[model samples]
Target: MKKDNKLKLNLQAILTDLLIWIYILGCVSFLVNHWFEKIIQTNFVVIFGVAAGFISFILGLSIGRKIFLPTIKTEGKWYKTFWGWSVFLLLLITFIVGWNLVEVDLYKLFAKFQNAGGIMKGIFNPNMDIFMQCLAALAETIYLALLATAFAIPLAFFLSFFAARNLMPQTFLGNTVYIIVRTIATIFRSIEAIVWAIIFSVWVGIGPFAGMLALMIHSIASLTKLYSEQIENINPGPVEAIKATGANTIQTWIFAVVPQIISPFLAFTIYRWDINVRMATIVGFVGGGGIGLLLLQQQQMLRWQNVGIIIWMIAIVVWIMDMVSAKVRGKLQEM
Candidate 1:
């Protein structure tokens, strides 16, 4: 009885697929009979495209039906289902549409490689004359990241208490404040570092200060969410014990929560500094005044040698920070 049902389903699907292809062919024949000459003048590209599209559609439908449409009689639920296949087909169709809209041509990408290679070769011979200036710009970038992280860490620490759900009841006032703080942090985080830099640049006139402001605001939003989550997940025993000892809310937090989180908080702050250092370079492109500003200027002026030196410097700094941060985090975790 199960075999009979499975056979019937497969037969029905094949018949449905045959009819769809027949209908497509009929439409193509009708078009060809009327507009053969006009299509011929444009060459066979259009006809080939239509035919290839139909062939691909039929092929995809056949393959997808076999995989997604479950025919197996199982004792338990099957992973392959009709609805799952339908969603898969819908996503496939969307991808095809997007690919066409983008007009991605690989030929253009290949064509540019020669010129790109020639420019890259020039970068091998870096101009050492600008090394001092580049070093200063790189130093400024590091300073910006350091300043931003310092400013944001303290602010994030305070805001996290208000954001932690475990600390606050779901009462009207508590819930309202939680929602507002969470929403604002989300909104701030959604705005990219570069966009923030642009806004601050306009407000304060372009400099490292603008970059610092951008990184600081973004860090606050990110660290608040991170710290709040840590607070929420801390050991409940200590919190309860502290409260039982007649400790007030602030006292409970300081004695119980703060001790648990201090190590992780320090680790998180160091990681953020590492991230900010990288971001400072990028934000500088929008007149935020870091090494990126210098790099961008060199690139625009066609000074690939200078740009190469700056690139190497940035790479070295990032590598060193990554190593240092890993060591610091490891030590913190051990503690």
Candidate 2:
């Protein structure tokens, strides 16, 4: 009989195994094809980059891991621990390389703000007319965020049921559905609200409608992730009891998971809406259409008082949201 060790070859499939390989292969081939032009760039990054230093530090861990790597004779705890570290190191290296390749300009980002010194001053100065105007726009932003949460809450609820391992149709079909929903959430979340707004603006014409849709999509994606995790963590007792009582899947979920998690879910939704309002400012910076749009315009026109009003408007809105969420969350926890 063959002796089977606990650590057999890892056969688990990643979400994008083939796609990852293809992209990695493509990048390598592309670099090789343009080697004459790319050699300097690649060498500079690999030889002197912080990412390279981090990579080397991690590569050095192999020496320690080798001693820990379980041989057929050594199925020790240290070996398993080292093995997990190796996987983490691999992921860290990948993230560093990808981040470096993005070529972010931290200096230029700061410089943009520095150029608006006068606008910054005006943002501090109080003005009644502009202040009232900003209030109206901010109200719109809040409304957009609230509406998005409303849509996302119900949508995410349904998706989470499909995503929950206990609540899924069956193991294989349930897992497949879970993955699909997870993928959709990931893709939507990956696309910034500004980008979504831009796409919608093109499709539906620019206004609060475009902004509302963008917030809605992003909110759904984000809330789904949280909702799924919460659903998965819920107690199985009520669910099992409900099932035993001949309750259908939907009924079981409603009676069991909903009762246990609704408070936390509502708290999270309120908190997310507050965050979305903050994000709405940035989204409007790129024509998502909120008080941020007015802020941008005022800064450009050097209307410092108007900028001041916008800042105050944002500050007030955010402060109110903070207090509201805190109060609601406290009450929910008590319940």
Candidate 3:
């Protein structure tokens, strides 16, 4: 029985090795034919290449089967079936197709570095003439994000209770309301804030207000999902205890659930605000009015000096916000 099982394994291994060798040989032959057909025009070169490749493949297979394959064993279920190899081949094909479709070229990327010195010179010697103007635009971006998040927090707080299944009454109407609220939130979240900005820019005729509205809408959807998940994960003990005390629904939430999730809710809200701040810079590209608008205009006009200043300003503001948010979240966690 042992001998029969070992023979079967050896046969399967040989078959797998033969398939891999055929695939590799085909790929190498195609490349060699395309690149060296003129350099080695003689039929002798083609025959010699094929002979060399076959010898190499045979040596590699012998070493792999005798020395390496026996030493390596995977006990996982994936290794026991063909599914793992199928998935790997699928990924390999996807990568090959995507590579050709994208026309990825490292040579082009390398060539662009030749012009980098001039850009760097302009960046280092930034134009200060429009300093105040750019600063005001930056300020407006921060204000817009803050205002949007402020408005979103309260609305999300209210909606999260409805969206959370644990908080719902378990009745048909309660389940229906949960599904509807969750679906709406998912739809809103699916559309990026930048797209929202473009739509609102058209609706409100562009400005900081348009950007604010866009941020607010996205923030509401995102925050509701976060808050609901947080509420759902809260300790159920307090909730049960509150119910046993004959506390009403709203009272139960206030006394039982709110205490546990408030810290995380604040943490998520702060993180969202940080994200909105970064997004606010981009929304301005669609005439949603902020530092990004100035940055875009400078870049289009080839005013690299001014563009450099804008970049630095954005980086500085983002760094500050990141620090502030990290500290706030740390404090919240402590509470």
Candidate 4:
């Protein structure tokens, strides 16, 4: 009973602090307008925002109470206290810096919002023919992702064993191989696929080929990480036993690690392919050529209904891919 009271008190204290912070934020903006000749009109928004803040505060308080029913037993509150204080301090510092750091008039923001409103609304009614065109492009995007992932999976498997410190020989020769593999993975992952796609599009000309190249590079990096982790985590006893029987490094790896992690590798590859398909669609916008090219063209042409169809079709494809990938991964894991 006493603990419950303490929780309620803590909640109240937290809410009170938030209210004080809100007022301080308003005042900070208020200062920018009246001081330093920088007229920041925060009044119109400040007034309404502050009012909404209070209303939200009351609603949030009620929700918090509702989450913990009367029958629920409370536990140690140290973690909660630590998290609450940490968050409060972080947010308080953020607000303090934000107020003095920048100032803007509410009216200008409102005007910009009003101006963009119509175009944003028009985005909903997309063009149907352009959308159908996007669907075809999206299929090409999926195909590129599939092909890239297929190429990367086996290649990554070979790279990861060399990369794994435990599996490789403890000589300069082995360490060099590890360094090379790691360096390649890091370089590939560091560059965004869209950037890769941009470069490839220039090299190959605008088409799915550029997108496939981008996906392949990205997949090599991502698959290397997943494969290396799986290789490093595999049971070492079988590897050691195989090595003792006069087996070569390749033979030992084939006998031990490959059998253990093949399922997981397949699972990871399937999941990555699904993710790549979705990313491939977006990369097309940068001239790599996929559904995104169609979507962008439609948007530029003011084909709202087509744009709507493109978005919906993309969503459906992504959803199906997710489901299919999950099921396939689950089966691979079971195997």
Candidate that scores best on lDDT = 3
Where model 3 places Cα greater than 4 Å from the true spot, the runs are 1-84
> Residues 128-164, candidate 4, lDDT per residue (tens digit)?
5555466678878889888888888878877888778
lDDT of 3 by residue, 51-92 (tens): 543454354433224323464444456544333443455457
TM-score of each: 0.76, 0.71, 0.76, 0.68
Candidate 1 C-alpha lDDT tens digits along 226-330: 999999999999999999999999999999999999999999999999999999999999988989899889989988888888988999999999999999999
Better of 1 and 4 by TM-score: 1
Task: Please report, in order, the local distance difference test score of every candidate based on alpha carbons.
Answer: 0.81, 0.71, 0.82, 0.76
lDDT of 1 at 250: 94
Q: What is the Cα-based lDDT of residue 223 in candidate 4?
A: 87
What is the clash count for each candidate, in the order shown?
A: 0, 2, 0, 10
As a TM-score, model 3 comes out at 0.76
What lDDT would candidate 1 get against the real structure? 0.81
**Residue pairs that clash (backbone atoms under 3 angstroms), model 4:** 125-304, 125-305, 126-304, 126-305, 126-306, 126-308, 127-304, 127-305, 127-306, 127-307
